[model samples]
Target: LSPADHLVVVRPNYATNIETPKAIGCAISYVDLDFDQGFAIDIEHVKAELRPNTKLISVTCPHNPTGTMMTRADLDALIALAEHHKCRLLVDETYRDLSYGERLPAAASLSPSAISVCSLSKAFGIPGIRIGWLLTRDPQLQETFLAAKEQIGICGSVIDEAIARATLERRDAFLASLLPEMARRRDIVQAWIDGETLVDWVRPQGGVVGFPRLNIDAGFDLDRFYTRLLEEHGAYVGPGHWFEMPKRFFRLGFGWPTEAELRGGLAAISAALRS
Candidate 1:
């Protein structure tokens, strides 16, 4: 990889904390998705970002924070563009299993130029497992990724892999049990948001996170609001600045704790908002 190789990334992405293009020696480009339009990526905008040095395109299905999914047509267009440009397309499908509608075909399954990465972290509630996989039909690319991995962590711990394998083996039953709980929690969060007068958001179509914008007309101090919420109400939600968004928006996670905890947290947040 070289700095001259431009790797385009979608923002409000889940894997931002982990896989960064700059870390891999690639220049970065970004395609801004329209939040008002369900956060759909504009294909034309993406094409406009492309330059002669562009070498890769990356996207997250069931996007982080907003939980918005890319349409099948949009994904196909991205894959086609990658093929036309002779660049790699990497699709991160960490939340694909939690999606509402028919899941799009894995990019790796579509073309040798595409790569797919998935993990047991988000949907499976197993971040501690630290097990994730990259899929590609191209043996050369696979070998190259493996070589890179060898220079890093080499391989996952045996125990972690065993647990991950077990989780995969019982995935159907596990998902069956978990889906209802996630759905229920999502509803609760939605209801709470609906009841709020000072907040607005596009309902998430899938996944565990939602981004809501605060109705602050004239420079309401988010730092003050967040600090007060944390100190007085003991409520914790991620600040929007972390996602490169306007300070009025904040990321809420509905998947981390039990229903009781989630409710309590929401109540505290609501109280903070009212105050």
Candidate 2:
């Protein structure tokens, strides 16, 4: 929370997770998720990074880029760890609503020490509204957050709030239509990965994205691949560097593109590879 405090972060994370703590000048440790391990985060790995001054531990569910989902038991363990250490656990649940199976309970609902963060930017595709919120059971903490918000700006746009409210009111109906389509797209992606010799991936459990690493052993020309993917095929992916990862890895998003576009993108990847 301060310059003298220690913060534990899960990586390779969204930029906000890394940048915010660095900006605060907090002594930081990273619990780096391993691609070989299916990007799994273990409680023991988290415990290893803990310092006595550790004030917050940050993690993501249905993680960005990798799209790995943590089990409910793992989440409970994280909350217990935070409680035992007398620290706070920040769970970024931005992609929680897009789960392929059962979704974990909101972290804040599980414990006063745990916080949940979410936005309409991801699942609902409404980033122009710039709406997001943090959840905490501690009233004092909530007040502290409001005070911080006051310092940043006068108030959020009324139009954005109204739109967000309307969206939330119809969330279930929206998701009911959206999720099945997401699953279909997800399957198409999975099938492409299964057949593609130039890449390998840990199948995403949820969310719109998957991190797939190019098989460098195949001697694929990555520089050409990117150039062709963009110039010739008119398709793009989030290069691994976007998430502070190796160049061999890339984030493929399935949620936004139309079915035809998704297939074209997959084909483009293959075409790029073959080139």
Candidate 3:
């Protein structure tokens, strides 16, 4: 999109979603998903934010940090809005293969005006390969996107392409081996949250991450909790500041760490809270 274009995006989104648009000098409107509402996207809120020049509406499924998934009806409404407004709808599906329930259809498949982007980075744990793709059914738009991609890098790396291909070839087997373990880890986190009054979460439906907030009043020493979590226990989390939220919220990942390490980290959170 051109510098003069307007973009509507979700707040507390993946950093690149906001950052890249800002870099392009696109005017942006943010539709914030609220904690009180379980971080679900309000379609009317999104529709209200659209401007005459809005070129794109950006969102994610199994969203980053919060790990909330959109219902199929909501997804359809978003696509319909984009179609009505003559703007592209960009759906980031990096974690699509990791769904804890029914997976929504790739948005691009349902609309010529929608774009779907996916990568092996999240679900396959292969960011080093640095491979991802964008999809659109519109021929003219596809050509424009291809021209822009060619200007940027000419083509993808041969080795990375080969590796990505091989990985996709066995994607089902990989997911089968991983999903059961992820479910167990997810259960462990749920049980911990159930037992703790110091913090609470919206309960992630999918993906490896969940954003939980500390249940503290004004007198709580929030800094001390973070300090003890790190220096005292060597545990780290994606701070809310990383997503432009208040420091009470943090992104906790349950997919990468071993079961022992995950339990240890959860325990550290408890100890740090008490300290």
Could you estimate the TM-score for every candidate? 0.94, 0.97, 0.97
The local distance difference test score of model 3 is 0.92
- Candidate 1 lDDT over 131-242, as tens digits, reads 9999999999989999999999867799999999999999999888777778888899889878888887778777898888888768666788899889999889989877
lDDT of 1 at 131: 92
- lDDT scores for all predictions? 0.83, 0.91, 0.92
Candidate 3, which segments miss by more than 4 Å at Cα? Answer: none
The candidate with the higher TM-score, 1 or 3, is 3
Report the lDDT of model 1 for residue 164: 92
Best-to-worst order by lDDT is 3, 2, 1
Measured on C-alpha atoms, candidate 1 has an lDDT of: 0.83
**Candidate number that wins on lDDT, 1 or 2:** 2
Better of 2 and 3 by lDDT: 3
Q: Model 3: what TM-score?
A: 0.97
Clash pairs of candidate 3? none
